[model samples]
Target chain A: MQGLAHQLIAGIATGGIYASVALALVMIYQSTHHLNFAQGEMATFSTYIALTLIQAGLPYWVAFLATLVISFGIGVFIERIMLRPMQNASVLANVGVFIGLLLVFRNAMGWIFDYTIKAFPTPFDTGTPLFGGLVSGHELGSTAVTLVVLGLVYVFFRFTKLGLGMRAAAFNASSSRLVGIRVGWMLALGWGLAAAIGAIAGIMIAPVVFLEPNMMLGILLYAFAGALLGGIDNPGGAVLGGFLVGIIENLGGAYLVGTELKLTLALGIIICVLLVRPTGLFGRVVQSRV
Target chain B: MDAGRDRIGTGIALPAAGAAERSAARPLRLLGLLGLVAVAAVLPPLFASSYQLFQLTLALIFAIAILGLNIVTGFNGQISLGHGAFYAVGAYATAIMMSHFDLPWWETLPVSALICAAFGFGIGFPALRLGGLYLALTTFSLAVAVPQILKYKGVEDWTGGVQGVFISKPDAPEGLGLDADQFLYLVVLAFAVAIFLLAHNLLHSRIGRAMRAIRDHSIAAEAMGMDIARIKTRTFALSAGITGLAGALSAIAIEFVAPDSFSVELSITLFVGLVVGGVGSIVGPLFGGVFAVFVPNLAESISRAAPGVIYGVILIFFLYLLPQGFAGFPQRIRALLRRRPEG
Candidate 1:
């Protein structure tokens, strides 16, 4: 019972992180209908930026705030500069653009810093356990932060004027434009919001994982699988999905196979999900208009 | 050589041999292309050093693989991220056949190509129902799994595990005045040219038209009586077969076969090359092939780690600035020049 309890708790902690990242992905995907293949990589870059600032002797909170602002700008700039040009391109070409940005973002990160692995400092001190258990404060802190972010996103989408405009533009650009909404700004704003959310997730998760150029590739896969499983179009579902995937993966490795096969197992689950339900557990079946 | 001259069928731009050039001019154009191919086929043997001979030879073999990728992704508009797996299949097929059964080079290469094509078709058949990202994920998973299958302890005795197979060079025919490296390069160059010529001619066939049509609009093509599933499977087979052929030649050139060589990194770079070179044009594969040769050579000139970083950076830069690729550079410059005179 204790071993199973430990497994479930560990899974929940990891799942919390995955859910946070996946929710950001869900936001972008919901608006654009295109997967930002560079989302995790972009997050990694933001975290690295924060780490660099903090390393240069800035306070953690200040550095975090500054990085968040920069990340917002970066996201908007990406939509305007890179994506705007390839607006009507074929699917292959559009995907190519995302891949191109991914490369640029990751390579720039490598170029800027030493390109070596660095340990990010956690907000919580290293001495204390969370709940008379072996789990650390950092994990608990991450889950709590993720919940707070999710709640904020829910409130923004549910209650705010700007958020409603963003959703309107996403639902139908033509109608949104006709309705006097600034559709273009809405798109850019969507990217900015997603990037800011992603940046927070990045900073939160960096302390748990090592910071490197290729660090996001693995996490991106997990987040993607989680997002898809949770229903990519639903932000809430995406969060729920990430937590479920994380827990299942953690417990599966602990009980059945082992750690080395975690990726293969994750992929297997994704394939199974794809086979059974292409729209995922919570997604609506979108009708193609072409 | 001008694309305009070749476009004799009005704005139709269909893949068949142009109606206007169906006479003596057509044969002459074939001769010119063949002549260029002939020179390329012979040049590797003329190089004195084995290193130059080896790199160019590997490039020739890789050209075949890239060309296959070109046809599938560039022309057919089906994105494949698992080409290196097909290459691995071909290499292991050839190596296992040669080492275990004492098969000669002549027999091994063709058989390897066939088996890979068949295997490719098999993988493609089951997965043909999928679309877009799903297809890509399936292929990526396959690429990751194949090497593991090769390295599995159950088949280690046959597949050589992680150490892989060390192949002996084939004996030369009597008094050909050819060293083994030079000989292998020449043999590979012949098949590569054959592939290029066939692919070139193929783009002029009904199948080629079907491929382009599918790329442009699959639903419309299906309405127009193009069998998407059959042709798509065939595209996978042909692409996989060419990649496999390249793999066989690569195995001979390296005289070694290991799972490590055909990593996901190799797949990424190969796809990057295709994108950076231009996807749909005939010159695209050639441009990608040149980039393939130059990037690593340039990397060797610089530091070792810089290659991946540099390659990624260059690919991204070109993708943002020139989506069409290096082949499109001249046209872009010409457009700039045309505007500058008036400006």
Candidate 2:
């Protein structure tokens, strides 16, 4: 019973991180209806930037803030420069470009940072357990960070004028334009916000996984499953889905399929969820017009 | 050449080639294409070293795989980022049969093809519910999970775990008395040509038109009495079957199969091949195969450690400059030339 308690805590902590990434995915999907295959790589690249800043003697929080800003700019620039021209291209062409971005970000990280795994610094002292030994300090710290980011994102979308414009654009671009929204800028802003969110996820995950070029590959798969589970188009559902996936993955890896088949377990969940509820648990049914 | 002349004259008079002209020119164009293939088939043996022949064989093998990808993705408009899993299954099917059952390498092709088709069909059921991006994600998950599944302890006995399985290269038949490299090249060429021709015919059939209609507008196609689900699943099966056959050939060519060999990167490479060669074109996969085999060597020559970055740059450049891919380059040139005459 004690062991199970520890695993559940650990799963929730990791699920919090997955929730952050899944929310980023949902943000882009909501705006563009395209799943950014490069989302994980972009996050990894931001985390690496943070690593370089820390190595160069900046404080951890300072590096984290700077990384977030730079990542946002990078995301917006990618939208304005690369993806804008492809806005009217075929789905295949757009997918090709996404894959291109993924290759560039991932291999560029490998080339610039080298492939050797490195230890990431935790903001909290991780030597001691927290919450009566159920969670480590790092786990508690990271989950708090993830929750804070999620809260801010919700508030931003719910209250801000720019957020409303972005939502308007995503729901209907021409309608938004008719209502005097700058749809193009709204799309760019969406990318920037999603990138910032992804950076936070990467930073939180780095300390646990140890930073490396391929660190996010498995986590990204989980995030995909989570996003699909909750609803690829619904932020709230995706967040819930992420937490559920993390717990399911932990328990499934521990008791059922074993750790060796953990990734396969993710695949199984994605297929099942997709087959059973294509709109996801919380998503709206998409209507196709003739 | 005569067809070109006829079309050029048509620009000055009629809109384009009429049926009579098309009929007259069809046999000539077919002969020309065949003649090119004949030259390609015969020349490598005459001048190249054995190692070069082996490289060519690998290229042909990749061409076959890319063509398979083209069937579902290019023609049928389904995006699969996990065809690598099918390739791996096919290779393993051959590897298990050859090593455990002591089956002849040539005899394992059908078994491998059948197994991969079955897996594709199983995957297709779930795919029937998913659309473009969702299907891509599901397939991507499959690609990411494949290596771990192959390395699972339960299958370690057959999979050889991390060390992977290796088989000896098939020898030349006794009557042929050819070297190993020569024999393998001929075998791959025969398969490549046969499959290419088969895909060509498949894409031009009534079913092919239906696939394209679905791609253009699925609702309209459905309203037009097309069975969208059936066409898609069957296309997926065919695509997997063709790629699996290629995998069997690739296993024979490389003489080894490992989980690492079929990582998500392999799927990306095949996707890159399809894009760089030109999607939705019959000849595109042939060029794609060449790109898949040679570009890495080119990248390696430029930088020892960062071939992937180089590949990424080249891919971006292709997307930016030649979005129609190399296969469409000739038509772009022709269009330009035709406009020049008018100007």
Top candidate, metric TM-score = 2
Candidate 2 per-residue lDDT, tens place, B1-343, comes to 3233334324444334565687788899899989988987789977889989999998999999999898889878999988899999999989888988899998999889989988998887786656668778988899999999999999998999888898888899899868888888988999998999888777778887788777767888889998898889888898999999999888888889999999998999899999899787788888999999998988887654466776677677787788767887888899899999789
Q: What is candidate 1's TM-score for chain A?
A: 0.95
Can you tell me which runs of candidate 1 are displaced by over 4 Å?
Answer: A125-134, B1-18, B92-128, B137-174, B257-260, B299-306, B320-322, B326-343
Error of 1 at B156 (Å): 6.2
lDDT of 2: 0.87
Residue B144, model 2: lDDT of 90
Show pairs that collide, candidate 2: none
Instruction: Give DockQ per model, in order.
Output: 0.27, 0.73
Local accuracy of candidate 2 as per-residue lDDT tens digits, A1-290: 88788888889999998888899889888888889889999999999999999999999999999999999999999999989998888788778888888888888887788889999988998887777788899988998999999999999889999888988999999999999999999999899998999999999999999999888888889999899899989999999999999999988878799999989998999989878888889988887765
TM-score against native, each model: 0.88, 0.96
Fnat, one value per model: 0.15, 0.70
Model 2 residue runs over 4 Å out of place are: B1-17
